[model samples]
Target chain A: MEKQVILDPQQFDLTVTRLCHELLEQHADFSNSVLIGLQPRGIHLVSRMLDKLQEILPTPPICGNLDITFHRDDFRRREIPLIPSVTNIDFSIENKKVILVDDVLYTGRTIRSGLDALLTFGRPIQVQLLVLIDRRFKRDLPIQADYIGKSVDTLNHERVKVSWKNIDGEDRVELYIKQTHE
Target chain B: MSSLSVDHLLGIRNLSVDDIERIFQTAQSFKEVINRPIKKVPSLRDITLANVFFENSTRTRLSFELAAKRLSADVINFTASNSSVKKGETLIDTVNNIIAMKVDMVVLRHASPGAASFLSKHTKAKIINAGDGTHEHPTQALLDAFSLREKLGELNGKRIAIIGDILHSRVALSNIYCLQKLGAEVLVCGPSSLIPKGIDSLGVKVSHDLTETLLWCDAANFLRIQLERQDSPFFPSLRDYALQFGLTSEIMESLNKSIIVMHPGPINRGVEISSSVADSSDSIILDQVENGVAIRMAVIYLLAAQIER
Candidate 1:
């Protein structure tokens, strides 16, 4: 496998700051607007964004973690079972403008499942998607992210990996390309 | 491991400590799912389940049905009294008939010891032994252990006493296997007649004294005296049995340290345990019932994920 650094630590912080600025411009003060982080990986990015946003804004919006394992389309279609994570939304999302956050936007199935999971809490006035990295042309569903930090084009055999400073001890995005053996 | 080692949950003996831990972990997630506003998930939406009870059941049947429905699975219920088993239909034929209708799983409760094992060999659907005579009630034991672990942090080095009928109650046997496998010490306390032969060979201490056994353990699981399974008198009388073995409030007051009380109900109120003690804060009988749904959901979800698409 061939590894290539897509975003270094300095660029990663700048991208998060730019994304939070875009969110502040649109949702202005974030009143009646909430952010929901997809579980396992998305929560890391969401918490980082929340920390950056709170530095400038007076009030932070209600943020929660949502797990979509039970709402996935591929329930029995896989070889192994999908383990669920903790969904810790304590407040209501009724008639709120909800932004669904994730680390990477891949096949768009996770967002689709997230949409279904979000409805179980309550109906939202509007729902939008946010991602740190968007893999262009790899979507299997008719879904798109409203906010994107960076968009990269790649082949299906290549992968995108995101690391956090708190978790992986560094903030970096790397692309892993499978080497051909022919 | 993501999946269970055995496809069918026939008994606790077939499950390893890893399998039990996985079940408890999955159940912790489902417990949150059920407490939500919707109280349902779509994991098993395309699958169909059949509750095939050859014997009578009220709680177990309702628990299984609710668990299946909560996962968004279609369910069909069958009871022996109303089914073709009365017309001489064999167990395989009944199960095969259900499987012919595209049922993916069978939750079975029969009076025979190995009826679940028998159906698993003859039928094509996955089998979950709801209760197989005096053999095993694996799900009940799972929920009981799950509830106990919730009240108590872990089962390692914890002392648990199984009180009351051991010969006729399948719950006791399943609990013994489950609690012991989780590293808890077990002691079966009852009259010599009700205690089965060679129970000590299962590696659990046997005692006839209730107070001494309760004093020795951290938790006491009092079982219901099954009069339906008793062919002849195992003890002198219900009054005599209550006087000797029943968990009364006086016994609760006598114990220096408070012990957790548990009962797998349709509790024989005032027979094996008094009503006050069963309803006490230390008693987790109702939590066991609530955990039953989540445990069954985890079991079915894990097994259904392994089914060939």
Candidate 2:
């Protein structure tokens, strides 16, 4: 198996800071803007973005982590799913703009489930999707990312894995393609 | 395996030491949350939890329901008498219907011992065994353990005696497993018939005399008589059982001064334990009830996390 690096550690940080600034500029008032990070990698990304937002603006956005395992579409097909991390959103999302953050956008099923889970809290005025890497694959739903770091063209069987030094002890993006046995 | 997940909490017998400790630590976190002014957490927000009670239970059912709600999870209450189960539907069918509604967890209390385990195996939703027959009440045991840990600082080397109808009380069975796992010497005291044979295999001592058992323990857990057990040949009469095994004020005073009294209650005032002892300073019955919610919160939270992975 061969692994290819797309983004280095420093490059990833700059892209995230740029995304944070762009998001801050869009929600200029910052009164009803909140960031909800999807669990695992997105949580760390949200934390980093939150830190950058605090330095740029007088007040930072309210942030939370969400685990959408229970709301997955293929729950019956799996043997028992492992418990995910806690979803901590203290403020109500009613009439507020929620920016859902994730590390990678693959099939978009996770974001769909995240939307389903978020609806149970309250009705949001709008929800915008954000992803570090937007691999151009056929999405099962009509959903598309509002803010994308980079668009990468890839085959259907290939996988892109993002590792952060703060989380996975390294900062790199690796792409792995499925191998066919002869 | 790097991680383990329980589909349901049927009993403590099958639980590993690490699993029990994880629940305790999670409950400890909720205990801190309980002391806060808000008294709620967003850990389980947007999740839906269903409480399915086949038998009537005010204390156990309410505690679990409140625990779920306090976690910001939406709760749906289902009673056997009001549901299709009363219309001759089987327990499995009823549970399956709830699962179809996409509930995240099910807190069940059935009159059968392995009911929770059965439901857990059948459903995708997580199960918390509230009380099932005389089999086991894992949450009650967790609460009992929590209360003991609060008072004694640790469960190691504590001599605890569970007194009264062991054969018909799920609390006794659960406490036995939990206490033994936590490094406590457990003693069972009651009429010979109510004490199951071969209970010593569980590393617990059996004593027929209450006075002797009281003298040898630091805590006494009294179990209530199941009115349904009265017809069985287990005992001659309720009066006789009371006179022989009951904890009167005088009987309590005769024991070691530091001994704590406990009962998984809705107490039969003067039947198994005296009213004086129940309300005394040495009694932790209320503490057990209060800890029930926190422990259950921990169980749901940990189990939910595992299922998410």
Candidate 3:
């Protein structure tokens, strides 16, 4: 396998700030909007975004973590069982503008499951997606992020790894290309 | 990513400690699902399940149905009393006919022992034993243990007394296997006749006194006397049995420490446990019933993933 670092701590910090500036431009004061972090990985990005947004905005937007394990289309199709994470939405999303945040946009299947899971809470007036990294040309579904930090082109055999300081004790993004034998 | 070690949940004896812990972990997630505003998931949208009960059941049947529905699976119920089983149809014939309808799984409860094991060998669909004669009610034991673990943390070394009708109670046997596997100390307390022969060989302590057993344990699971399974009188009379083994609130209040109480339902009200005790705050009988859905959902969800489809 080959590994290449695409973003170090300094570049990652600037990308997050850029995403937060774009979010402020879209949802002005954020009175009628809610922020949702997709569980397992997306939560990290959303947490960092919340801390950054809290500094600029007078009031931080309503936030919750959504787990889409049950709504996934690959229930019995996977080799290993899918374990679910916690879904903690304590506020109502009725007629509110909802922004779904995640660290990476891959095959769009996770976002598809996230959409289905979000509807269970309540009906949202409109929904948008935000991601730190968008892997171009890799989506199985037509899902594009409203707010994007960076876009990278890759093959199916390659993977994108995002590490946070609180979790992996670093702030960096890397691409891993799996070696194959023909 | 974790899957069950076994394809079918035949009994607690067939399960490992890891399998039990996995089910509990999954059930913890499902418990959250059921509490949500929309208590349904699309995990098992394509799977079909048939609840085939050859005997009468109230909670187990409904619990299985609710669990399947919450997972968004297609379900069909079959009761032997109203079905072709009353007209001399064999067990294999009835189940085979159900399987012919493209059923992916069968939750079976029959009067004969090892019925689920028998059906699994012959049928193409996965089998989950709801209850089979006096053998084992694996899900009941699971939910019971899950509820206990929720109230009290980690059952390791905790003394649990299984009181009343050990011989005819499938719950008792399965509980013994499950609790022991989780490192809990188990004591079977009942009349000598109902306590079964050579039960100590299973590594559980046997006692015949109710008060003594209560004083010696952390939790007491009071089982209803299986009057339907009793061929002859095990004791003198219902009054005499109540005087000896009935769990009343008075008995609970007399204890130095408050112990958790449980009952796998269709409680024999005034006989095995009084109404006051069953309704008291100390009892987790209702939580046991509620956890029943989550535990069954976890079992079916895990087993369904193992299906070739």
Give DockQ per model, in order. 0.65, 0.05, 0.68
Task: Give the winner by TM-score: 2 or 3.
Answer: 3
Q: Which is superior by DockQ, 1 or 3?
A: 3
Is model 1 an incorrect, acceptable, medium or high docking prediction?
Answer: medium
Docking outcome class, model 2: incorrect
Alpha carbon lDDT at B61, candidate 1: 97
Model 3 TM-score, 2 decimals: 0.96
Candidate 3 C-alpha error for residue A33, in Å: 2.6
Model 1 Cα lDDT, one tens digit per residue, B1-309: 368889899999999999999999999999999988899999999899999998889999999999999999999999999878999999999999999999999999999999999899988899999999999999999999999999888999999999999999889999999999999999999999999999989999999999999889988999999999998999999999999999989899999789999988898899989999988888888999999999999999988988888
**Residue B168's C-alpha lDDT in candidate 1?**
93
Regions of candidate 1 where Cα sits further than 4 Å from its true position: none
TM-scores, in order shown?
Answer: 0.97, 0.65, 0.96
- Candidate topping TM-score: 1
iRMS, all models: 1.7, 7.8, 1.5
- Model 3, position A69, has a per-residue lDDT of 91
Across B1-309, the per-residue lDDT of candidate 2 in tens digits comes to 123245578889888877787777667657655544456666577578999998889999889988887777899999988778767999889988998998888989999879999888888888888889889999999899888888888889999999988988899989999998999999999999888989998889999999999999988889998877456567888788889998999987666476888998888988889898899998999988888888888788666655563
Candidates 1 and 2, the one with greater TM-score: 1
CAPRI-style quality class for the chain A–B interface of candidate 3? medium
Error of 2 at A173 (Å): 2.0
Error of 3 at B158 (Å): 0.7
